[model samples]
Target: METVKRVLVTPEAKKVIDQLSKQHGKLMFHQSGGCCDGSSPMCFKEGTFRIGSSDVRLGEIAGCPFYMSRSQFEYWKHTQLTVDVVKGRGASFSLEIPLGVRFVIRSRLFTEEEFARLEPIQNG
Candidate 1:
């Protein structure tokens, strides 16, 4: 059976991830819940941003692990998140900000079949 991914990345976002990875080495992503960046996805160097047990590991995008706070996950659990890049600087510390772009999440609700085959989530 084909596994359904909880998180995905667009080609444009992948290019940005590759560029950032080349400079920063390993990278990871966190879905911010309406704080510094308004519900935007933040990128960080792996092991830099602290991931606590309260966070949920959605999946990987561009070889980097993606996560969300457990509280936030409660609301987004039924949706598949797509990491997309936009052409504007965001007011956050995400790596992409310096490059005049920010990582944003585009989500879609999963169908019953897709939900049934979703990849298992992990506790951070």
Candidate 2:
């Protein structure tokens, strides 16, 4: 069966990830839904942040696992998320802060065909 990817990383984002991994080692991503971070995807060193039971594994980007809270997933499940890099410092504690570039999400709704082929997400 054909598989559709739910998360993606742009080349610019990948370059930043490469830099971050060199300094921080393995990494993971969690999409923040407002509050302190204001809906930004935060990056952390793998195993540093706890994955809760209510989180869903959306996919991986730059070899790092990406997740979202179940509540956030409900709102975004129909879309494809592309991780992109942008200038300026974000308010979150994500690793990219020191590099003057912040990771951002660009999303678009999946087509009916793509949705049908999308891989299932796992509950954390």
Candidate 3:
């Protein structure tokens, strides 16, 4: 069977990731359930943001591991998330903010067949 991806990245987003990775070695992304920037996927230098035991690894995009708090995952478990880049400055600590571009998520509900074949998630 073909592998199912929980998250994907857009070409525009991939270009941004390549640029950031060159300047920051490695990276990771986290989506939280809090207000403000917390709702958006925040990119950080790998190992900079702490992943908690209750966090869920949705998958990887552009070679960077993507995670979400378990609580947040509960609300998003049925959808496939795609990371995209947008021209705007977000109020957050995500590295992309400095470049005048912010990462955004574009999501869609998985089909029944796709949902059944989703890859398992990892904790923290």
Candidate 4:
């Protein structure tokens, strides 16, 4: 059965994305394994990761574009996010959090470049 869930941006995450977007850059996030288990998805977006009442706002972190993750996108896709009912808007889809895996939201949506970036990593 198909499912739909929404995503809400955390206040702290919003701050980080906002600062990065202003610099003008692209947010790149990766999930890696380690002993200490730095499980929280890492934030490496160059530009802003902004969050508005409707869309996730990105300012400019390092002169690049920022974005979000598949899982994060999925959460938001399904409407799992908490935003003003009349203000915020997120993509609606069903995304499952992979087992023993962490994700990052570099920005809000996926683009051709980001898709290409992720393909290699996933295949490798």
lDDT winner between 3 and 4, please give it: 3
Per-residue CA lDDT of model 2 for 18-124, tens digit only, reads: 99999999999999889987888899999988999999999899999999999989999999999998999998899999899899999999999999999889987
Candidate 1, residues 1-124: lDDT per residue as tens digits? 9999999999999999999999999999999999678999999999999999899999999999999999999999899999999999999999999898998999999999999999999999
lDDT of all predictions, in order shown? 0.95, 0.94, 0.92, 0.32
Name the weakest run of 10 consecutive residues (lDDT summed) in model 4: 92-101
Q: Which residue pairs show backbone clashes in model 1?
A: none
Writing each residue's lDDT as its tens digit, candidate 3 over 1-124 gives 7757889999999999999999999999998577877678899999999998999999999999999999889999999999999999999999999999999999999999998899999998
Sorted by TM-score, highest first, which candidate order results?
1, 2, 3, 4
* Reference-based lDDT, residue 5, model 1: 98
lDDT at position 93, candidate 1: 90
- After superposition, the stretches of candidate 3 with alpha carbons farther than 4 Å from their true spots are none
- lDDT of residue 51 for candidate 4: 31
The root-mean-square deviation over C-alpha atoms between each candidate and the true structure, in angstroms, is: 0.6, 0.7, 0.9, 14.8
State TM-scores per candidate.
Answer: 0.98, 0.97, 0.96, 0.30
Clashes of each: 0, 1, 0, 55
Off by over 4 Å in 1: none
Ranking by lDDT: 1, 2, 3, 4
User: Candidate 3: what lDDT?
Assistant: 0.92
